[model samples]
Every structure is written in structure tokens, then in C-alpha cells.
Target: MKASIALQILPLSHSADRLQVIEKVIAYLQKQPVNQVVTPFETVLEGEWEELMLILKTAIELAGSEADNIFANVKINYGQILSIEEKIEKYHS
Candidate 1:
């Protein structure tokens, strides 16, 4: 089944630049198969749950590698597509 994954990543160190970290994430994702699903920098992605999880994990790792002193906070929210559709319909009414 397909799912939507939303990731909010923040760097742990105050010295770490936010824009640089975001850029590294975008660049890293661009080189991966996951980029085929959508533009690499998109905050939201729709795909198989397992694939999405793997991509997110890989992205976090890449981000960490770009800055060894950097740390990340990640949150993964999962929902079945039917629930999303129902919510969309409810909001449209």
C-alpha cells in the first residue's frame, strides 16, 4: 500500500547552518532513486511505506555525513491513503 511520509529534520548543534544542512539534504536526495518520485527537495513524498522509510533513513545519514559535528532530529508520521482521502473530502465540504 502507498503512504505519505513527512520528515522534519533539525540540526542539533547551534553552530550548524540550517541552509547548508537543507542544501546537502536536497543534493543527496537528488542522486537517489527516490528522486524519481518527485522533486528532490519536496517535504512530502507519496510512495510505498518501506521505500519511504529507507529513503528517509538514507537522507538523514547523508545529512549527518556532510557535517560530522551535526546531529538530527527526525519525526515520521504515517497514515493510510484512505484516511488522507477521507480528510480531504471532509475539508472540501
Candidate 2:
């Protein structure tokens, strides 16, 4: 893979809307052409570097618009990266 991005978005919003906002972000990511693994805290995306960055930016923007503010953490491994399958394939059921 060209890169992998692990994104966690924390949106400051009403408790009622917080989960909805997060769902929107994940929905957007799911539409992209990438390998994805979603966890309780973050989502890991593996694909081309540019595509991943753009997807990350758009997901953050989508979250920010529905909340008071957005705090996001993005971890990127460029040039050389391990895909989600490569990291956890053996553990799959």
C-alpha cells in the first residue's frame, strides 16, 4: 500500500448528535475505494496516499460542520505501510 491513515475524530456536540455525526464520518469513509477497519475509537484506511489524505480531510470537515468543534488525530505511514489485512488477517475468524 502507498499509505495507511488511522483517523480518530472527536466532535464536541450535543450528546444526542455526537453519535450521528460520527456515523456520518464513517459513512463517508466507507464510500471511498480503500480497505477500512473501523474500531470503537478510530478508523484505519489503507490506499493511495493522496486519496487517503483527501478522505481524511473530508471526514473531518463533515464532523466539524455538525458540531461545536472537531478534534481529530491522524496517523499516517507513507512510502511504506502495512495494510489492515496484513496486520490482522491471521486473527480474522
Best by TM-score: 2
Q: Residues 1-93, candidate 1: write the lDDT tens digits.
A: 666665545566566787788777766656755423233344555567798788888878877765555555443446656433453567677
| RMSD over all Cα atoms, model 2 | 1.7
The TM-score values for the models, in the order shown, are: 0.59, 0.90
lDDT of 2 by residue, 1-93 (tens): 499989998876664387888899999999998999899999999999888888988998888888878789899889877778889978996
Q: What lDDT score belongs to each candidate, Candidate 1 first?
A: 0.61, 0.87
Model 2 regions lying over 4 Å from their true place: none
How many angstroms is residue 86 displaced in model 2 relative to the true structure, after the best TM-score fit?
Answer: 0.9
Return the clash pairs for model 2, or none: none
Error of 2 at 49 (Å): 0.7
Task: In angstroms, give how far residue 48 of model 2 lies from its true place.
Answer: 0.6
- Global local distance difference test of model 1: 0.61
Q: On a 0 to 1 TM-score scale, where does candidate 1 land against the true structure?
A: 0.59
